[model samples]
Target: MIKDIDKSDVIGPKSIDSPFLGSIPVERLSGGVKTLILMNNDSEHIFNASACGDNCAKWILKIAEKKDLIIRLGYLMDFGKDEFDIEIVNIGKTVHNSLELAETVLDNHLI
Candidate 1:
């Protein structure tokens, strides 16, 4: 079961450098939640999940780079109303594979 995260816990805008991905911004959105937003042209794909353990950001960046679909995350906060929308395709399998690949690469040396 996925636990709900409070918005007040988010902390970041931290910049990380990568030879392949360039400069990417990562944020710890909550105790177990982390997110990264990727900009492709005018569209922004926001990736968020609770699995952002050690090395999760790097793997997430890789997933964002590999996907062909564009996903958008929208949150509405007005008069105490809270709602969100996430648009994407093959998210689960794709992200799982990407994270696994990233872990493997991290464990080994890249050439």
Candidate 2:
């Protein structure tokens, strides 16, 4: 996914190969990649989902399936039309699809 998004191949723990930039350190990766990495590895911290673009929504859902993930989104994130179970913590409701999510978000002013 990082490869697709960043156009960089992760070569090693601290190395990555960007087609245009040549070899670079991991620190040079985009904020979205860094945020996704943190969300994937550290289950103890609450991540600011606002740092991620809509592209990261699916990954966030994937991580949630593996472990409990609590994220705060400052904007509306399109989770696609496919059915998904997301508990809106603010409204105490579980939404199944983007439409439901949108309704819930507006009803609760979550975004």
Please tell me which predicted candidate would have the highest TM-score against the true structure. 2
The C-alpha RMSD in Å for every predicted model, in order, reads 15.1, 1.3
Highest lDDT: which candidate?
2
lDDT of 2 at 30: 79
Clashes of 2: 0
Output the lDDT of residue 29, model 1.
35
Location of the lowest summed lDDT over 10 successive residues in candidate 2: 1-10
Clashing pairs in 2: none
lDDT of 2 at 16: 95
Q: How displaced is residue 40 in candidate 1, in Å? A: 18
Ten-residue stretch with the least lDDT total in model 1: 75-84
Q: What is the lDDT of residue 95 in candidate 1?
A: 22
